[model samples]
Target: MKPFTESMLNQCRKYMFNFFDYLPTKYQASARDWQVRKFVWAFKDGKCAVSAAQLVAKKIREQFGTSASDMVFVCIPASSQRKNEIRYREFSEEVARLSGAVNGYSHITVEGERLAIHESKSGKHVNDVQVINFDKEFFKDKKVLVFDDVITRGYSYARFACHLESFGASVIGGMFLAKTLFV
Candidate 1:
């Protein structure tokens, strides 16, 4: 296991504190307890992240179609330098596992964005992963739920939804494994 940096520890603490404050009084302690459980479980094995992501995805799926065929599962890359966050390969893998278990998806597809920070000839370039391609045919006239490891400010999700919309896909919803307190 990588040593948790002082910065990382501090960030976790700060996030917990904020989450604590966000809860109603009755839920404050319960929320903290759950957070601790999640932290420990998530680090224990890759299953924790995947499990949580699956739950979120499942909820979205339930709302859209009685059948998984009514929806497509699309996720951002688990690792993105532009996001400066931990990579979630295990989480992504788990999501795939859960999706397979449910047995009715029209298809599961991943969203791809260029990693290079491109510099345009005019001196301005987009450097982050932009939703550029999807399984176009599979999603045609299908509802999609976009998944991510976390959502701090919701900008990433917004970008993804917009991209899907542009392509004439109906975005049924978005799901995140965890939402950090700080944007």
Candidate 2:
């Protein structure tokens, strides 16, 4: 079922759009989910960020309609500058090019590495080790769409939205290729 607001956390009332519902690994994912997972792995490996982003861009264009033209799109940053460069930097660029949305990749810069919460055995929050720098004036009164390959729990989107808001940007929504289903 599609929920109107993607962030279950009430504090983050950002609008979010997801293209697919995917079952978690614990459960057998749907065929469509598996297809997306293949691309997600390829994207994470830096092998198909552009191609996969193109598909995402097409979907964004289809779903977002005219509103996308008014918003800037930023990808969720990887663990470090190096990883982000390998993954999302190029991905976001291609998405911007294909989707015709303003590229917000350069607007936010990340320094330092954080523990990968998805891979971690110990508990850690993404913001603890992340240093995100941006020109406050650039985001002032701007609308931003946060893009990610997938959303599991959405802590990242919520925190990132809060961060952008701190700098005066209105995080209008989030866009993800897929959202994981627990069952």
| Local distance difference test scores for all models | 0.47, 0.77
lDDT of 2: 0.77
**Which candidate's lDDT is highest?**
2
| Residue-level lDDT tens digits of model 2 in 1-183 | 324244336424557777777665667767877887776777777889878787878877887887778888888787788888888888888888888888888877889988865566456445557787776787788888888777877877777777777787878778887887776
At residue 112, give the lDDT of candidate 1.
45
**What lDDT score is found at residue 68 in candidate 2?**
77
Candidate 1 off by > 4 Å: 1-50, 65-67, 80-132
TM-score of 2: 0.80
Could you estimate the TM-score for every candidate?
0.49, 0.80
Stretches of candidate 2 exceeding 4 Å from the true structure: 1-13, 28-33, 122-128
**Residue 158 lDDT in candidate 1:** 62
